[model samples]
Target: MTNETKIPNTRWWRILPATVLVYIVANIDRANISFAMAGGMMEDLGLDAVAIGMAIGIFFWGYLLLQVPGGHLAERKSAKHFIAAMIVIWGGCATICGFISTSFEFNVVRFILGIAEGGIFPAILVIISHWFPPAERARANSIFLLSFPLSAIISGPISGWLIATWGWREMFIIEGVASIALIFLWMPLIADRPSKAKWLSAEERNWIESELAAEAAAKKAAAATNKSATKTSYRELVFDINLWKMVAVYFLICCAFYVLSFWLPTIIKDILKADIGMVGWLSALPNIAAALGIVFFGRMADKSQNRRKYCIIPYVCVGLCIIASVFTASYSGWLSFAFLCLCGFFWLSGHPVLWTIVAETFQPEVAGGARGAINALGNLSGFFAPMLLGYMIQNYSRDAGMYIFAVLVFLAAVIVWSMPKNAETKAAVEKTREHVAATTNAHA
Candidate 1:
């Protein structure tokens, strides 16, 4: 604003694609298990629904081990190096999944894979925080999160075809090797922050640095007025009521999300009475809707001050759609599929807003650890959701587990609604708005 040229958004072009690609590969490795289950891994390994669920759920246990430490390392050390090492290690574990003969062996490899992949999410979030300022963060998060649905869209048919043509073993080998190869691409493209990026012009770097510094100052100012504004340590953060509220919300959200992610292939196959290949193609539809919803709702949240409303609305809609899909499945497969697409749209779209809330709530110093703790605790539901759903599907009707998913998502919305307003985030947003306005005036 002080006679400097307007900073270009060079970070988005340089940073987003690399992050998106890394997540896509990571998700493909994570989610391809669903395809493996549907495409005969269960029968080959002599696993029932319960046994497979346990194997799938066990991954989350290992996932919890590294999250906090990974986040701390990324914040204190280097995200680029941390993520690169994880990619190589996880890729090796994923490849080992194809070679396992016993259920114990499968579970072991999956646990190792989970440990390898645990830190990647929080590390990437830290990286995003370093480069994008508060005002642009929601949209940046949404774009990065596109990898979730986009991975499903790509992996669905591709995984199905791979299994059909070769075998589930080969599918695992192929995807794992592909994830390993991506390390080369990720290493060269990513920088820890704008300051470290050689490709960034001095003006852009200065703009980013100044904007981030102003937000940090705003947070410190807010902390002076609000007793609970800043948390200094993990022990203090654990006892914080606001942190627990967010963890509860995220835990419920993950319950619904993982249920759909892990079970959708089998659900689709059941609905249409179709083969695995057709199920793969059909599974892509819901994710296409999810992709569109993320872009639209992410922009909408960025434009509005009441981002909480955006989060609440989508969660409520997701709950309703899940119930509707269950009811419609008996009458019409296509109708049921339509409702599932709606569920995907709403559930996935709300994620960026939720993360934006977390990013805004914490200071830069504790942001990494706070995010890691929330993510680790929230993801514990990933373990229980699948196992519970599998037990329900095995014992009762398929729709039985879905009813619980609907209720869980509804509860998530209620938690979001009840959470107290975040004073620190509000102050930061106000400061960001003032900074933007001043910059505009300076340009004029």
Candidate 2:
């Protein structure tokens, strides 16, 4: 079918299922390390918390380096093929992680894993941007993000059990196999954009086109008029104030999130003096809270149509919770459990809206690249959060670690608040729509 003939009525119903499955595997692979660490990988490897954190953080090093290129590739390639290829490679690496005995080997596998997985989130974001209109974007993002929490929920208990019964390596192999299975399932379902979807209804296509066109037009006009111009260059994103602000936001969020991912299982185990089975179940609690948090924040952003405040509020709340938890909770089982749930809820609440803003901020042609660049840059904190927190906990105290996280979370909120709103973003979006239309008309 011709591009024009195929543009309308994409069956989102079909695409969403496959997208969710891919997300689940991707997230589980990304996060299963937490389970490994808690399950005894650290002692077995004879590594300190700092060493483990550094190893885990190194994944971000590779992940960040490849983001822009990955984005560029996503723009040009078939999203399904790209995702499928990456999954098999990374998932295989993850499975192999189970067999490796040395820290160096672990680092190597993780670095490779990072490179392989770097493209998934940014590419998915770009795909979602094309598939859904601005009004529907948050909801779409929410649904897609559900995979993150769901993966955590599955990974936590299952991984813990695997670690207890079979060993951490076994957990990796099982999850890896699941990822490989998903690639085949995903192959037939994912297309690059709604325009390419074959099963969409004629009316649905027209409706989406109209919504996208209108939104894009407003974005363009705003961009054309904005005078406080921050000229975006491939190189200058590193130096750009707006980019830095975004980086700060990312860093802060990672502080909270990485802590939960890396340390929550340990915290639950330590606080309750729980055995492996109990620790596994307890690890799932925070993820459950996070899942609810993502859904709530996503729907709120969708309802409010305001990304900035929506993103900021939850982050700030997370910071407050971190501070409060450090003081009130005696590390008793019940208090720790309650605090974990609260921290998880608030800490994760910002992501859906933040991701939505990231999707809306860039031009479609380069959206993937920009998203990847920002995400890559922003992700630098992922490495540090684990390292820094682990160090603090080992040397200072858990309270000290929580305090540091509170500070970082608060810092992220400040940066988000400081960022000059691109009132022009909406206009730029609108202009792009008009440009696409004019080009289409000219061709006709």
Q: Which candidate is the best by lDDT?
A: 1
Q: Write the residue-wise lDDT of candidate 1 on 288-398 in tens digits.
A: 998999988899988784678889999999999999999999999989989998888987888898888887777667779888888898999989999999899889977
RMSD of each: 2.3, 4.2
Expressed as tens digits, the lDDT of each residue in 295-334 for candidate 2 is: 8888888777778887888888888877766676574567
Best by TM-score: 1
Q: List the residue pairs that clash in candidate 1.
A: none
TM-score for each of the candidates? 0.95, 0.89
| Segments in model 1 whose C-alpha atoms lie over 4 Å from true places | 2-6, 224-226, 422-424, 427-429, 432-444
List per-prediction Cα lDDT, in the order shown: 0.88, 0.75
